[model samples]
Target: MAHEKRAYPLWTELPYAGKTHSPTIAGGVEPDAGKWKTYFIQHSRRHGFKKLDGRPIRLAIKDPDSIDWYAQLKVVQHTLENLSDQEKRIAEYWSAGPPTKQWIPIVDRLIDTYAIEAPRAARILSAVFGGMNDAFVVCWALKYKWLVPRPNQLDQHLATYICTPEHPSYPSGHATISGAAEVILSYFFPAERQKLHRLAEENAQSRLYAGVHYPVDNTEGLRLGRQIGRIVIEELKKDTVNGLPIERSSREFRNADIITRTYEQAIPFDYKSKCDSLLIRDDESTGNSSTKDWIDPKLFI
Candidate 1:
């Protein structure tokens, strides 16, 4: 299907044009395919119309510092900006045309029901929902350092989930952040670790699916995420009562336990129940919870 070109707001398109513009309000001008749209739109008005393709937008951010010099070689900012553009495009495409509406209810239900009843589980789900923030931060940080190019610039035939980012590519931040959050959640839900791991991997792969990340960048990001997760797990292990992690005994685990108890198990939280409030305090105080009660194994053991 072909997308008709829509008239974009002038301010929005200027940033996308990647010019040496300071953080100022945009002048009322749209981008022409041939013009350099930056701090000020420079053009050869006197002579016949011409465009200056002097250097890529990414390189112009660099200054003459030792750090800047190393950054030129590394291409950090370039990669970050490129990946960010890719992510934005992916999100926009998905928002414009979602695969289905059915999953939204399911995911929303899962997030709400589990968050209060099972806070840790809620955190896990939340982490999964918009966890890409970390990846974006990483990419933005690196983009300032490195100025690499997307695969599309190198070769046009590469199909992507979103349009290729207009910057450098290295150290896939999406993969790293997604992997980190997944691995951390996995410790609480060990049985589902494999599943979670796959989910994280797929999330990274989605970048590839979107056609923005190279295989190496994504792989490196996943590796970085795993390391981050392991560290988090170690930290959380210390957040326990008598060596037992409190997050494991949270509401989701209890719900899971109730499910296992009987086919006729009652739904846990009712309007008048004090158990809801009780558990909140117990968790806050680092009090030991009995293992025999209904516990979600993914969270506890």
Candidate 2:
């Protein structure tokens, strides 16, 4: 099998970084990537509402020699070559920061939109973050265990649109977190299930558009994340009062709806601009705020 071969380079060097630094086979960034596993191991020792067991969550993936692996690589190459303007925007949008950075704002928006109370909102945040943490832990364990080479590592000629992250590529962190967030948030806000799912799919596909991950990486990450999310939901159900599961009522906030509509109606920002510093300007001629006003201008920088 291709995985057994020692000749093929694994995720060893930073591809996007120029040739100045020495390429040693030492540990890449976040050598302690699997340290989060301890959180689950020590959960019982500490005070917590739910106890999550991550041992049962396993990811089964195709080997590098399989036809499906090569086909997925071809998909990544094709996506990079034929990326549309919208695809490029999507990639750049999700590439702003760590997966959690983007998700925090989304959760906040959902909380505000639904006018959730303090207790329910806290539970929502706890479940979402817990699931994400578990996803990262399990994802990193499999990532370093498999040591799968990234798309660029497989093909040197390929130039990614965004800088590749300094980690082994098999399961995408962004996609995993997106999937986990989607499932948990959907369980809380069933009304926005379809829209939440679309966001998750877009987040997963962004990795492909950026040429950073293979199709299987995103798909498996989503699957793993969803499984972990379901587990989190089940654990949450265990917390009951008076022999019944605790529940909260969510009231719709009309102002949040209007704000969301206005924000979505704003124009998309161009990421290729050559601005020196962060600047927000209004189009006085049209009496409308520019895209920068609506979107996070920091992401462009």
Q: lDDT: which candidate is best?
A: 2
lDDT score, candidate 1, position 117: 58
Q: Per-prediction TM-score, please?
A: 0.43, 0.74
Off by over 4 Å in 2: 1-9, 13-27, 37-55, 60-68, 248-301
Q: Which candidate leads the pack in TM-score? A: 2
Candidate 2, pairs of clashing residues: none
> Residues 1-301, candidate 2, lDDT per residue (tens digit)?
1455553356654343222332233435454565455332222222211235534433443444342555677998889778776776677667665667667767888888777899889988888887788767767766675666777666655666665665677788888878888888878877777777887888899889877789888987887677667777777767789898786544333333312322231333333422221122324421212223222222321
For residues 1-301, write the lDDT of model 1, one tens digit per residue: 1214322111122222113331122221111212323211123445312213322112111121212222232342344345544443333232121211212332344345345356665655544333333333333444333433444433323323343333344455566665666676556555445555664675565555444555555666677556545544554556677877666553233222211112121222211211110111123322312211222211110
| Worst 10 contiguous positions by lDDT, candidate 1 | 272-281
lDDT of 2 at 35: 49
lDDT of 1: 0.38
**lDDT of each structure?**
0.38, 0.63
What local lDDT does model 2 show for residue 246? 81
Q: Indicate the worst ten consecutive residues by lDDT in candidate 2.
A: 273-282
